[model samples]
Target: MSASTHWLATASIQSVLERGGNAFDAAVAGAFVLHVVEPHLNGPGGDMTGIFATADRPGEPVVLMGQGPAPAAATTEHYRAEGLELVPGAGALASAVPGAVDAWLLLLRDHGTWPLADVLAYAVGYARQGHQILPRVRDTIATVAELFTDHWPSSAAHWMPDGEVPGDDALLRNEPYAAVLDQLVGAAEGTAGGPDPTGTAAGRRTAGIEAARDLWARLVGREAEAFLARPHRHSSGTDHAGVLSAADVEGFRACYEPSATVSFRGHTIAKTGPWGQGPALLLTLAILEGFDDEYLDPSTELGAHTILEAQKLAIADRESYFGDTDVPLGHLLSTEYSAERRRLITESASHEFRPGTVPGHPPFIPPLRVDYTPPAAATGAKTGFAGIGEPTVQPDGETRGDTCHLDVVDRWGNMVSATPSGGWLQSSPLVPALGFCLGTRLQMTWLEDGAPSTLTPGKRPRTTLTPTLVLKDGQAVSALGSPGGDQQDQWQLLYLLRTIVGGYSPQQAIDAPALHTTSIPGSFWPRTWTPGGAVVEDRLGQEVIAGLEARGHVVTRAGDWALGRLSAVVRDPATGQLAAAANPRGVQGYAAGR
Candidate 1:
């Protein structure tokens, strides 16, 4: 079973399975297709985090640490010298070392049955031929059309062919990107021996894929170095040059890390280490575990209030300490710590950013909001990042935010959940030669000194991209994730509550209404906070909304089907059965299984 944000990606997974590939192969194929079909959400130059359980080692989950670190020259002083208080959301200056491709390749090489060429074939076809443009893609390009035309001419040429935004029905093509993928295929083909072929299972555990991985790193490093050398207009409304070097790219590599986890109910939830926002979800679950059954029910007035408050407290902790550096995760996830943090939640909403107090370490509180009001000169230009423009849905209706998520579970009991994001189309200027953009993930850092997420060379920004793996009784059971910027885990938490506590099926849990608190400081560029703010789907009804508002929550209804694009796949090893479900909000999501 497999589920993804787009039908094409889901179908790609099924195609892989039909071709006798395993879950890892399907995941690799689907991930590449997501790059083609959901360009607005992710790109070749992006980053990703995944948690997977291989059939050989069922309960042992591994974290795919594809969250690339900042370029060696990306220092706080350099950005400050460029006359910027906060990192620019979309620009060459905000870019990080690209890592998603290498990470996916690593997974494929280590676990997948198919060769590199087979996995990339789907993306190559879609990019060379044409895929129907998503409305959101058209909208994103249109929003940044002026910026592209007036400043980033390379982007204008790529996204806007005739110097105009493409319509939703337009068949969007990226021949350049297809060419890049083809080159990667060629690299793999060059090493493929008579004993192995691209699509055949004979190539399992062969050197051909390793050769392709080596060539890919060298090629991307060379191109990224060349692109960063050229100056581009930044979100600062000024032309700023990048400091990345070929060495920065070549030195970057993705690896497996031990997953951080916390046991709740009868399950153990695995997350990326403190470097990403996964720990926040675990902490929220810990705090909520202390609540009564009634308050834990998310559909009720009291239950909703409790969940929101607990989320706010846990997210505040994320802002304070979670980062790339060595974190005191043991202390943070301790039972004593959970008890201490649970005391912070109250009946009324707490607008304060209160990170927990460790005995030896002092807490670092980031600026409530890094004043990101656009400069007077750039007023005419669209400010606040591309995908994060004014909320897509107003009280009436609007659409906003973008990311790609995939979950796969095979007949062999292997499962994986990966959330790929960062190098979105609107994140940076087009690297014409590569037919993709660099990720502006460096913007998730604080420039201030002594903070865990402070900008430092070779350190990863505290990324919001997080994937989830759930294990019960020391056996792998499910893999789940979503894509909603800071709301990623917040939405996942709701799904967990519904599925684990409310006893809803994966589809029923995902189809239910979702909400997330914006009261904590955001981790995106132009980081800001909203006091007592919460956005909920109207499907929760007026009574729930009224109850939340009466409890001091600043409630905003985002219409029914306006939030969350989560997908999940589950495996019942005992019965050899697999099931899956996808979000129904946008009609783009799909799920498939035998």
Candidate 2:
């Protein structure tokens, strides 16, 4: 069984599985297809984080660490010298080393059973032949048309050929990207005579994957460094050259690490380390674990209020302590600490940003900007440009380009949940040679000297790409995730509460109303927060809305189904039954299995 944010990715994974591939192989294939089909959401230049439990080690979940560090030149002094107060949300100066492609290749090399060419054929076919352009892709291009035409001509030539935005019905093809894939395959096959003259299939396969990895580093790094060296327009309305170099790309490698886990209601929930926002979800669960089952319901006024308050508390801590540095996670996720934090929740919504204190380690308080007014250039005051930021919820409760998620559970008990994001077409200017742009993930960092996530050389910016794995009785049972920047875990919390505590089916939990708090500082550029703010799907009911508003929550009622884009795959270890579900809201995500 497989579920993904796009139908094309899900269908591709289904084909891989049908052809006798394992969960890791299917996930790698689907992820590459997502880069081709969902260019506005993700690309090869992006980052990804995944958690999986193999059939041989069902009780142990491993995290795939694909997030790359800042380049050696990406220092705070350089950014501040440019007269920038914040990292531009749409420029190469904010770019991190590309990590998604290398990470996927690492997974395929270690755990997959298929050859490199076979795994990449699906994405190569789509990029070369063409796929129907999604309406959202066209809309995103329209939003940035002026920027592309005025400054990023490479982007203009690619996204808006002949100075016209492609219509929604157009068949979009990225022949350059297809050729890049072909080069990778060719590099692998070209090594047939080296190392192993006997021509053994396994030796050839191993040699091929290694060759492809080396070629990706050399080719992508060289092209990106040369293209982004010239001055370009940024979201800050300034022209600046990028700081990334080919050496930064060549020095990075993806690896596996043990998962940080916590038990909730007899189920062990697994997530990445504090470098990403995955720990915030575990902290939220720990706080909510102290409440009664009734208060955990998302449909009722009390339940909704309680959940929102709990989320705010967890996120406040995330802002203060969660980063790539040595976070004292041992105390943060402890039972006593959670109990102390839970006691701070009240019947009324709390507007203050309060982070719990850890013994001997003072929390770093970030700047709490309540509101943001974009510069005229970003706001279209000069050229009719829309606001630019990471694909997340706006202050008005409207969602823009976000991330992609996938979950696969094979019959043999192997399970994987992955969230691949960043490198949207709007992130930076197109690297014509690579047929995609670099990601602006460095915007997640702060310029302050003492913050844990302050921009520094050779350090990863705290990321939001988190995936989840659940286990019971020392066996992996489910894999799940979503694609809403900060709301990813918040939405998943509702599903877990519904299915585990409320006894709802997977589809029922997904189809139910969703909500999240915007009270914490955002992880993207122009970092800001809304005091006591909560956004909810209107299907949560008028009574619940009124109840939340009465409790001092500045509630925004998103239309009937505008909140979450979650998907999940489950396995019944006792019975060997497999099931899957996907979000119904965008009419895009799908789940497939037999």
Top candidate, metric lDDT = 2
lDDT of 2: 0.89
> lDDT, candidate 2, residue 587?
96
* Residue pairs with clashing backbones, model 2: 380-385
Clashing pairs in 1: 392-398, 392-399, 393-398, 393-399
What overall lDDT goes with each candidate model? Answer: 0.84, 0.89
Clashes per candidate, residues 3 or more apart or on different chains: 4, 1
Worst 10 residues of 1 by lDDT: 389-398
The numbered model that scores best in TM-score is: 2
RMSD of each: 2.5, 1.8
Each candidate structure's TM-score, on Cα atoms with residue i matched to residue i, is 0.95, 0.97
Off by over 4 Å in 1: 194-205, 375-385, 388-401
**Model 1, range 307-390, lDDT digits (tens) per residue?**
999998888888888999878888888888999988877778877778888777778888886345756255575443345421
lDDT of 1: 0.84
Report the alpha-carbon TM-score of model 1 versus the true structure. Answer: 0.95
